[model samples]
Target: MRRTKVDRRVKLHRELAEFIDMDLKMRGASVILCEIYGKWKGLREKEKDHEVVWPPMVIIMNTKLDKDDNDKWLGMGNPELLEYFNEYPAIGAHHSYGPQGHHGISVLIFESSTTGYFEAEGLG
Candidate 1:
């Protein structure tokens, strides 16, 4: 067998929600990192920049994703995630906040077989 396995480390904004871990658990999604959006937060932490930097978003991915899968996702800017398993490995934005917090979240979905290349881009 090909033994297809595609995995990734998704970093989401902290101010997006109270508990993304709980949200993922509620939706039954595996979690790679369960900490707040610190890198960005840390930057302005000393300055106490309490501005909304990360929005509410969900990173629902089926681990064991393959390079081919990632290749597909790369093409599609952002497509629905739940339509086809191993096809479009993403589904929804789940929730979000203002521009500052809204932008930190970035995700893309693409499949080379059926939909060709579709997308919705975010960078939070």
Candidate 2:
């Protein structure tokens, strides 16, 4: 007998994400994405770690905003977006957004190694 357990009021939401990892060989799916966002905070000049390396990146910035606005993307503004660049420093934003920022960044970041923010902490 197949018992179908149904819980009322149980609305399900789905989250999707992608990233390339040597450990997973690009296919773990432990989660569509990392359940966590916050990693490190502030980094310094001198520290030793393995994950703290300049990884490859693939970005798709606010194409929905402006193709020329490399400095900025979306409402994030040229400055805020650049700040992200200087901080983690991505390769570039692809800007594959639709007419609205809703389907924003559909195929950028993640999987693209460098685009992902490196934990600011841990000096390296």
Give candidates' CA RMSD values in order.
Answer: 19.3, 14.0
Please list the residue runs of candidate 2 whose C-alpha ends up more than 4 Å from where it truly belongs after superposition: 1-55, 58-74, 77-79, 106-124
- By lDDT, the best candidate is 2
Could you give me the TM-score of model 1 versus the true structure? 0.23
Angstrom error of the Cα, residue 57, model 1: value is 11
Instruction: List, residue by residue over 1-124, the lDDT tens digit for candidate 2.
Output: 1232232212221211223334334444353234333233323425544353344333333424443444433544434454555654443433344454323442223223322443222112
For candidate 1, the C-alpha RMSD (Å) to the true structure equals 19.3
Per-prediction TM-score: 0.23, 0.23
